[model samples]
Target: MSVGKSVRLFLSEGTPGGLITAEIMNWTGHVVAAPRSDLAKLTKRPEASRTGIYLLLGEDPDSVGGMVAYIGEGDDVSRRLYQHSRPEEQGGKDFWERAILLTSKDSNLTKAHARYLESRFIALATEAKRARLVNGTAPGQQPLPESDISDMEYFISQAQIVLPVLGVNIFRTTKPAKKSISPVTEVAAESGTESPIFEIVSKKHGIHAQAREIDGEFTVLEGSMVRKQWISTAAHTYEQLVPKLKQTGVVVDSDDGQTARFTQDYVFASPSAAAAVVHGRTANGRTEWRIPNGGINFGQWQTLGVENEPDTD
Candidate 1:
């Protein structure tokens, strides 16, 4: 008869359960566990102190070999094993008909510990079954071979298939990091100019504004567009424009302590006149600008936009 035909049993603490023994017949009518003595040792071992995993190996002289049906652990390893070995329990069934218990003295089964024991059991069981198979014993009756044990172990290793003992988790958890952002500035274009120049405007006073070059046919940055104004090709481009406009006698002042500011005469005298003085764009104004603030960048000023307009005279 197949091992599945064997009756399975579970034993735990029962009333008057210091140690108990009983036996039952398997489907094959095999005289399994009649007054088995192996269980006696478990009853004698101290309770509530031991902890660790125990392996149960079946034994049958009449069969080619036996198999391992269960793995267990407890604070009292001896008592736990004894419960499973009771004749009336799995001990009487063909499944654990000739059971041998392999146990450790530790109570808590750590993940690593459980894994190690499982691997060891499979390795040993496989080897024994292979030897039996080679000896021409009843192949079907042979205990699990080392290879079979390995297969079983592999099967259990799968997260979905393996059911860990209560209170144990196969995976660990971790936390994610937090994200933060720094202040950003915006640039807007004024009327009668080429494209609006975008700059990094500082939040603190005495900071300089950092200028950025407008790209493509369109003069605009990420968040908004510059309209009706000439924007600088780049910060350096302003250097060239300032000197030429200065030669034209345009009076300039420091806009914010950082930028060289050209009065309306330099920027809006005439569209053609402004275009003639500037090479790349009407403004070409980055170099011509300075922040009155001590340390702000033009880029920062642009980000702040007109919202940072000072009080007019």
Candidate 2:
């Protein structure tokens, strides 16, 4: 079951690209975010001086189609931001382009709490594998009172919910993109229900892959087969992703070394990317992917009830 959540966002500069603040209806946590270019202005904000955890986000030049993140704790977030804002040669990270600071409205968060959150977030981000973590290691969690631990856990859950809305998704460990779904005719559906399993098979290429559109992401399930090599005509955007997947261990060669299989369930930005990767070349995902044994392609199944096509049943 899911309940509605209200998030109040205020753009301090009255611009989407400028400094922004967010808060949940009943959450005491306050979030401040800004681009690295606005660091000077952000450091002047009162909340930037509070004890809190911060996340740095930017594209990873080293990894194709993924982002990099660094989680840390500080009594004065502005100070740490300045340190990281320096050049990498000065012992600072230069990869980040944006920063998000988390603090409490009542100033109740302490150094211990921030440290716990830093360690917890790092571990969570590592497990999610959504981004390459800049953290060298996960710090040990300090022991806190049982009640405080419970409170912080709730805080973490709330942060998880709020972060994604801010375009920060390093902690998204699951495939489901949205929490709810509309009812469809093939099978009874409900909120949070998994998408129907779909597959793409090509006996000629020795490829058989299973996938599902969880939430809204098109995810190729683990053990799905991929073509042996990407063709020259493969979509340029996703062509390099094939090798990157193999290098990251997301996909690996099978026992016979004839083709490859996905080591873990992987999400593609779209059905076409999933299809292109599975086929090792350019392909039409809507027509390529189909409901196994049902004979209906993705294009057909997804458009159900949209028109008054004569029933073939």
lDDT of 2 by residue, 1-313 (tens): 5465678889989999988999976678899889988999989999999999999999985563479989999999989999999899997898899999999888999899998889899988877788898888889997899867766766776677778778887886554534322122122122233667899998988999999886566788999998867876534877887888888888898887678999888878888889988988888999999999967988887887797877999
| Model 1 lDDT tens row, 1-313 | 1011112332334422222222212111111111234456444544323444444444433322212244444445556655665565454323453222222222233334444544454444343231111111212322455754443333232211111111111110111111211111111211111233433333342222222322111111222111212345555432354454344333233445433333321112222223323333443343333344444434354475556578798
Q: Report residue 313 deviation for candidate 1 (angstroms).
A: 99
lDDT of all predictions: 0.31, 0.82
Backbone clashes in each candidate structure, one number apiece? 59, 0
Candidate 1: 10-residue stretch with minimal lDDT: 166-175
Instruction: Kindly state the number of residue pairs that clash in model 1.
Output: 59
lDDT of 1 at 182: 12
lDDT of 1: 0.31
My TM-score estimates for the predictions, one after another, are 0.23, 0.87
lDDT of 1 at 126: 43
Task: Give the runs in model 1 whose Cα sits over 4 Å from its true position.
Answer: 1-35, 47-49, 61-75, 86-112, 130-313
Task: Look at candidate 2 and give me any clashing residue pairs.
Answer: none
